[model samples]
Target: MTTPRIVSLVPSLTEAVAHSLPGALVGATDWCTHPASLDVERIGGTKNPKVERIVALAPDLVVANEEENREPDLDALRAAGLDVLVTEVRTLPQAVAELDRVLTACGLTTRPRWLDEAEAAWDAVPAPERRRTAVVPIWRRPWMVLGRDTFAGDLLSRLGYDHVHAGHPERYPRVPLDELRAAAPDVVVLPDEPYRFSAEDGPDAFPGLPCAPVSGRHLTWYGPSLAEAPAVLTTALRAALD
Candidate 1:
C-alpha cells in the first residue's frame, strides 16, 4: 500500500513522523515545532486542533497521542472518514515500542536507523548507583507535579531521581509551594516546557534546594530526541550538584 498522507497532532510524534517519512506529513499542530524548518499546514494546538481544517486537508491519516489529545476530536475525524493512529507511551520502554508500532502502521517495512540508535543509547546507560529524592514541578501558580504513572516520572526514576509525588493520587497533582519546599528534596528538576521553566525563573521558587533546569523534550519527548536524552539529562542533573 502507498504510504498515507499524515497529519500529526502531538509535537513529539510530529517530529517523529516528519523526520522518518519526510513529506509524508502534510499538516501538524502549531505546537509541532521540532525540525524548526518544518513547513506543514498548522491545524492548531494539540488540545484544540481545527478538525474542519484537518478534514479539508484530506489527509489519509492523523497521528495523535492519547494523553495530549481529546477523544471527541479524534471521533470527529473518524466520523469524517479519516484514519487516526493514536499512541500511548507512558514509560521509556513503551516509547520505543510504540514508536516502532507507529512507524510500521504508517507503512515503513523496516525500522529507521534513528530508532535503533535511540534504543542503543538507552541500553548503554547503567542503572543509577544512588537514587536521589526530587520534586519535579511541571507548572507553577497551581504548582502541578509529576505524580503516579507518568512518562516523565518514569524517565526520571530510571535516571536516579525518585519523585516525591510518585504516590500522589493525581497523575499531575497540584501541591502547595511551601509543602514542596518542605519535602526537603535533594534536588528540584525543572523542564523548559509546558511551563517554560528556566534557570532565572524556576530556581527562585526553591531557594535552598539544588535546581536542575533541563530541556523538556529530553525529559518528555520520545522520538529522535530519545537518542540523546540520557547524556543530556545526566549533564543537567550533575550541574545541580555543583
Candidate 2:
C-alpha cells in the first residue's frame, strides 16, 4: 500500500494539521516550524507557494488557505489538473469546519476529540472587559493594523474585543505611531510573522502600553485550533502584565 503523499502551501496548516494527519507531507514552507519532522522543504509561501516544486513532489493532495494563497496560483494548480484543498477560516467555528473538511479530503473518516476541546478553549476566556483592543498586524517603516471589515477584526469582536483600530479600515492599514499611542488599548499584541514582532521588538509604538508578543496563528487562524490561543496568548499576556 502506498502512503499518501502531501504538500502544504501554508505554514499555519502545516504546523497545525498536516504533520498530525499521519500522511507523508513531503514539502512545506520555511515557517512550518512545528513537529520538526517534515522540515525538509522550504517551498514558497501562501501567496507564492512554488507550483513547479509542488508539482515535482507529485503530492496526492495540496493543502492551502483561500486567504493565505493567491487566487492566480490556485487557478494555475487547478488548470494543471491538481485537486487543491483550500480552507477559508474566518471565525472560530469556521476553523472547526475546516478541520472536518480537510480530514474528509485526505480520505480519512476519523477525527480526534481534541478538535472539540480546542474549540471550547476560546470560550473560556472571560469576555473582554470592553471590546477595546488595538491590533497591529505589522510594524515597520509605516505601522499597519487591521480595520473594521477584515476577518481578523471580526474575530476580535466575537471574542468580545472592540478592535479599536478596525475603525481605520483597509485591512492592513498604515498609521502614525502617535495614533497608535492615542488608541490606548487594554492589550496590544504583535504577530510572530509577516512582521516578526517580539516583546523585544516592542510596543515602542505605544509607550506605557500592556504589550506582548504572540503566535500570529495562535490568535488569528480562527480554525480547529483556536482553543489553544487564549491559553498561549494569555500566558504571554501574563508575563507582560506581571
Top-lDDT structure, candidate number: 1
Worst 10-residue lDDT window for candidate 1 reads: 200-209
TM-score of each: 0.97, 0.85
What tens digits encode model 1's per-residue C-alpha lDDT throughout 1-242?
A: 56678899999988888889888889999988998999989999999999999999999888888999999999999999999989998898899889998887777788899999998998888989999999999998899889999999888888889999999989999999999999999999999988999797655799878999999999999999999999999999999987
**Tens digit per residue, CA lDDT, model 2, 111-227:** 756676776675676866645465455656777777655555565565555667676646677877777778777777677767788666664566688777877777666444566
Model 2 spans > 4 angstroms off:
129-131, 149-160, 222-225, 238-242
TM-score of 1: 0.97
Error of 1 at 25 (Å): 0.1
Please report how far candidate 1 places residue 107 from its true position, in Å: 1.4
Give lDDT per model, in order.
0.90, 0.69
